[model samples]
Target: MQSGKFKTFYLPLAAIAAIIAGLALSFAWAAGLLGHRTTTRTFLGDSLQHFEPGYRRAHGKGICFTGVFRSSGAAASLSKARFFSQQEFPVIGRFSIGAGDPHAADTSTTTVSMALLLTADDKSQWRMKLNNAPYFPTRNAEGFLAQRSAFEPDPATGQPDPVRVAAFFKEYPEARKAVEYKATASSPSSFAGAQYNVINAFVLLAADGKRQPVRWSMRPRTTLGSLSAGDRAKASRDFLFDDIKQRLAIAPLYWDLTLQLAEAGDPIDDPSQPWPEERKQVIAGTLAVTGVHDQAAGGCRDINFDPTLVPPGIELSNDPVLAARAGIYAHSYNARLREIGLGKATEAVGHGDSH
Candidate 1:
């Protein structure tokens, strides 16, 4: 009788204990056991972790410069931001290739990029991230990761496996637009001549609290120019730097900041879907690139061109990739900081050959 009583009570308790233990294990496994962003359903941290090896924790590689941002006060009508006024502030800028690797080749690389950090007297700042390409490789962070995984180089070949890349395109057909665009746009001859775009959309607010979804770009005052294959083949590794340095000696470069208003049916949330060319465009301001500098000691070397760092009158959109960029960049930055503390890095992060 006593044995039966003990057996019934203990058996039930043991079963309950097993269930609780299993649940605890499951929770732990789900938290991080799957791996970083690639394997698990997580946020920016995980997605950014995958890029550490490929990018060397630099996020994006470029050369830094310093200049002046001249405002026509025209953008104030579009958005009442202080920088859009007639005020002139010191500008820190960067010129880069698309790859994240700091040491990537300069001469033959096709994707050109520019970053501007417009700072005010009170330390408030506006950052504009512009790329030469009109379209990005992937639409969102999910597509970005899928593209990265597919583009992983074969260890022996040291190049992307064409089969995997083809399969990736099959799976995510949206990436084809970017692939085609890049195919047509070889690297331009000089940074001063190529147009740069703020492909991501933002809501610019007038002082009256009305907001408008808008996209913006900077068109070079100089006519757009591209290099021929022969020029690229015969160029030195530091050709871009040499050219820009020589170019700056002649005159300050210029680009007009053109902001486009989104019409009805235009996709404001999806940066991958560009607005039609016929959309209403306004010349918000002018960007005068007065000078250039080396990344090692320039203002842009240490700064992140935060997408959401707008003043009071500008608001960020609900674009997922744009949202994730801030966090991902923070993660990349902290990782690099830790790596640098451990003596794995030098002070020059986005330094070019000229540095």
Candidate 2:
């Protein structure tokens, strides 16, 4: 009788203990999966493994430009930020090839990117980081790191491993948005002709205390000259960089900063998930890029357009990827500074758990 009672009680207790132990082990294993680490250094190391550390940054790896953002009453109702409500704001912009290869050919660089730092008289600033793609590839830091890992240097050849990248794509369906966008995108004749998009959603705090979720795109005012494969193929190595310089010399380049309001049921947390094409859009202001300069010795050289440098009147949405980018940008900036013997100044601080 005692044996039977002990068996009934002890068996249940043993089963419970086993279940608890299994859960604990699983949690620990899950936490450490995919070379995930909590520190900025470790995460960035993984993120940039495919590229060598250089004075240039990971994304905007080429020319830098200085400009001015001419704001009007258009954005005054949306946010109380001085830069947006004021007449003019000094802008530091960078134009670059897709990757850290500063000398990467225009045709080889699948997408071009732009980064801007808009500063107001009050010194309160807002930064916008945009890419030519209509959508983002990976939505979060983990996925971002994982995708980069897929392109990590091959042991035998020291080049990108196609098979690994293919495997990663097979596992991640969301990454298709980036691939499709890049594949169909027509090469712009000049940086001024490129349409830069802000895929992540942000909350704009109105002067009247109303909050609205919005996504924005900076559309080039210039009629873009489409480049044929033959045209890009036959062009000089630095054609994209030189083309921008020539274009800027003629007249100020213009990009209308257009904001799209997100309706209810829209995906505010996932940058990979773009809102419906029919969403309401408002033209916030014009970004007049006045000049082009070398990235190494330009105003934008030291400026880290921390995507989350959200001004007082603006708040970032719950998009995990968007939230995590500020730290990554800081890390990249520190790396650039360190590479040029400028030395690392400070550590990055931002929201979201590091993966």
Candidate 3:
């Protein structure tokens, strides 16, 4: 009788234990903590997480984003070179902040950003990550990468030591600007008022094979929709992920992707020089975020948005950073792909549809 009673309880307990073990295994797989998969997942997570503190440092609060895609009714009049046009393809937009690591709270006051992109014939996407503001304080991508790597914590302490940051900032001018920007920005409201810029450094090619330098801008539909001070203080680190998930759940986040085409003889290389608003030709296009891709589920993590994936009509115009990014992004993507057993990635539209 005692054996029968013990068996009854033990069987249920054993079953429960098995279920729990299975769940833990699933979580491990999802987190990419299993074997070689861990490397790829960790790299992607590190890249995204790298932005968190920078977002808080810049925005003074946290981060939030909305992504929208083009609706079918709208006409895509974006010009193209060669036989391909920018209008023919559909796009996916990923809006984020220039700062804020994956671990930091998304509600931090970093600059709001968006990447509007379209799928090319080759299955590669052509996307441009843009900020709400008009200029990037960093001198170049290499400089940006160096500062970011340094800003991360010292492995020994696992804490962000001010002394280390100070030493890094001593060499990086942009880090100095960041320090100054944060020193004075005491309140979230003060930081919210800070104008963010998406430094334009890419060239758009027209149907005539002419290259026009471009800067893109997207102003909020309503300035009243900004986060409150309380929101910042109470927000979770995943505020951006949550905010975007909620917004995309209800109404689509809408933004105008305005292109300011540069005139002839304008310098194409230097992004520091702002094109006069009057001289900037605006080609207005609507960006609608239909859905938020899951970062945890390999949506945002598995891919690299290489700007070289230009559609037919859009061409690269000797932008040094763009050229460098093309190679770097390609290598990184391939590395992650190889580690994850994902195989090689396809190239963007260029030749025939052999991709």
Candidate 4:
């Protein structure tokens, strides 16, 4: 009887262990650990799988940043880029925060944030991630990331400390200019009321094949636009989204997509500094949001548009961030792809199949 009982219990326990081991192996395989097949599995698993979930829970789609696609706004005239010659092209813009988790509300409370996306023709897309200040103190990504890491919340306590903020700039003196600029600024009624810009200069290719490296800015149209201290006091975490929704409901949000041309052989790598107005050209284009997209699908989905995805005629003019971002973003995107079930193996196959 004892021998029989042992056989029954041991057989079941062994079988269960075998199943668990197989699952672990499969998971690693899916995560790209074992071989090429595993790598492909990892890619699919990482890339688009979380898009739906993120959209549902976070109320955002994973596009350029944290903001959702909300709605694919109407494609109208070339009004935003007022100075450019008349030629129309279908384009899309995704507004989002520059954060790790795509679902984070784009509150002005953060140290760094942005509205990043690609142009329809892929001629002038950018990661327009900036802080509340007008200028960036660091000349490159390394310095910026270092400072951001230090200023961000402490992993242990999940609280951002004044000491960390102070130490970040103290260690990186280049940040002083930007920090000072932010400090002296008048406190706004709402952080969401502040305008965001692409601090780095980029190239905006015109219909005639001319490339103009430009800085893009989006500002509130009305004088009643200021977000006051009282307003900020009552501001919701998703103030930007709500404010945008309200604005789009009443009137289209107009943004003049201006181009700042770079001089022949001018430095384009370090985008921290701006070209003088006299030397730069302001080629304007219209960006009107007829409607806001679904917050979740627009912001938290698995879509990440990298700056390097520029089309022909619109080339990288030796921008450091552009080059750095290309590699970093490619690796990041690939990693995320691997995390999902649709791994890299299938992506290449699909790309080839399309051709």
Q: Which structure among the candidates has the greatest lDDT? A: 2
lDDT of each: 0.73, 0.76, 0.50, 0.48
Instruction: Report the C-alpha displacement of residue 102, candidate 1, in angstroms.
Output: 2.2
lDDT per residue for candidate 4 within 1-355, as digits (tens), equals: 9989999999899999999999999986544355444223333343223432112111132222222222112211212221233244433445443344444544443333334453433355433343445656677656656665566678878977778777776777767777676565553333234555656566655545555565555553443455566776677766665555666667555544544556776556666565565774343444454555543233323445555554443555566555555444444555554544453233222222110
lDDT of 2 by residue, 1-355 (tens): 9999999999999999999999987775444421233534556564554244344446635667888888756877888878677888888888877766544567776678888988888888888888887877876767766776787899899997988888888887799777677768777777778888988899999889999999988999988777888887798877888788888889898999998999999989988888999999888889898888765556666777878887899999999878566666766776766754543322211111100
Candidate 2 vs candidate 3: which has greater TM-score?
Answer: 2
**Superposing all C-alpha atoms, what RMSD in Å does each candidate have to the true structure?**
7.0, 9.5, 17.3, 14.2
> What's the residue-level lDDT of 330 in candidate 1?
54
Per-model TM-score versus the true fold? 0.79, 0.79, 0.58, 0.57
Worst 10 residues of 4 by lDDT: 69-78
Give the alpha carbon lDDT tens digit for every residue of 1-355 in model 1. Answer: 9999989999899999999999987766544342333433444444334343212343255667777877777778778788777577888888887665565567546778888888877777888778877866666777777887777789989999999999889877878998788667776888888888888889989888778899888889998567888987887766777778888888888888888899877877787888899998888777788777776556565677777778777889888777766655655555565665565555454333333
Which 10-residue window in model 2 sums to the lowest lDDT? Answer: 346-355
Which parts of model 3 have CA positions greater than 4 angstroms off? 1-78, 81-89, 97-101, 120-125, 145-198, 264-266, 298-300, 342-355
Candidate 4 or 3, higher lDDT: 3
Global Cα lDDT for candidate 1: 0.73
Q: Considering lDDT, which of the candidate structures 2 and 3 is the better prediction for this target? A: 2
Model 4 RMSD in Å is 14.2
Counting only residues 3 or more apart in sequence or on different chains, how many pairs clash (N, Cα, C under 3 Å) in candidate 4?
Answer: 61
